[model samples]
Target: MTVNDVKMILDACILCGEQYIGKEVHTACGADMMSDVLAFVKDQSVLLTGLCNPQVIRTAEMMDIVCIVFVRGKKPDEAMVALAEESGIVLLSTDHRMFTACGMLYEKGLHGGASD
Candidate 1:
């Protein structure tokens, strides 16, 4: 699904990189802790997180995640938004909690990361 589709599905507000709404993403993983994300995530295109810090963007960059969805309506601060924009990552904020947000994407065919 495209980032636009994700935003629509999650009813998210774009916090940055609006130009990248058409970006394609097939896999997603949700985690508020960056440590779990770094340790377990792989080949993932999107991150659904409640973490609202610069580290989230850094982790996305390290793992090549193209989009970040902030769950439970959490919005990152301005510096965090700047970091994401500079790194070419699209940021989205949604009111859905972690589990429900992740499930919504899964139900729409966006799945977990590939084990490869």
Candidate 2:
């Protein structure tokens, strides 16, 4: 599905890189810990996290993630938004908790892209 579809599914607000909302995302990984994301996340995925920081942007850059959805109403700072914008990574924020957001996406056919 596309990032715009994800935004509608989760009722998320675009915080940055709105131009990239049309980008397609076939996978999703929700984690508060960047370590798990770094270890297992695949490329062209959407990252759903409660942690709002610059490191999240850096991690997305390294992993080639297409979008980030900040859960539980958490919003990143100006610098983080700028970083995400610069990297062409779409940022979205939703009031839903991490689990619900991930579940909603999963129900819409977004997987973690993880292997056994």
Candidate 3:
């Protein structure tokens, strides 16, 4: 799916990276643990997470994720947004819980960061 598709799936806002909305996403990962994000995610353009902190952006940067979706209405601070913006990572927020958000996107064709 594309970043536009991800925005639609999560009903997200373009908190940053407005220029990257057309980018395509082949995979995704959902987690609050930065360690898990670093260890498990691979080639995922979008990150669904509730950890609205600087480390979240750092993890996305390290993993090369193009976008991050903050779930359950968790709003990230300006510092986190600045970090994401600097890293060229799009940021978004949604009210949906983690499970529901991941399920919706998965049902719509978003896959985990793994291949057969």
Top model by lDDT, which number?
2
List the pairs of residues colliding in candidate 2.
Answer: none
Q: How high a TM-score does candidate 3 get?
A: 0.93
- Candidate 3 root-mean-square deviation in Å: 1.4
Tens digit of per-residue lDDT, candidate 3, span 58-90: 888888898899998888888888888888888
lDDT of 3: 0.85
Q: Over the stretch 33-83, how does candidate 2's per-residue lDDT look in tens digits?
A: 999999988989999999988989999999999999999999999999999
Candidate 3 minimal-lDDT segment of 10 residues: 107-116
Residue lDDT tens for model 1, 1-116: 99999999999999999999999997898998899888877663889998887889999999989899999999999999999889999999999999999999999999886562
Q: How close is candidate 1 to the true structure, as a TM-score?
A: 0.94
lDDT of 2 at 10: 99
Reference-based lDDT, each prediction: 0.91, 0.93, 0.85
Worst 10 residues of 2 by lDDT: 107-116
Name the candidate, 2 or 3, with the larger lDDT value.
2
Rank the models by TM-score, top first: 2, 1, 3
What TM-score would every model get versus the actual structure? 0.94, 0.97, 0.93
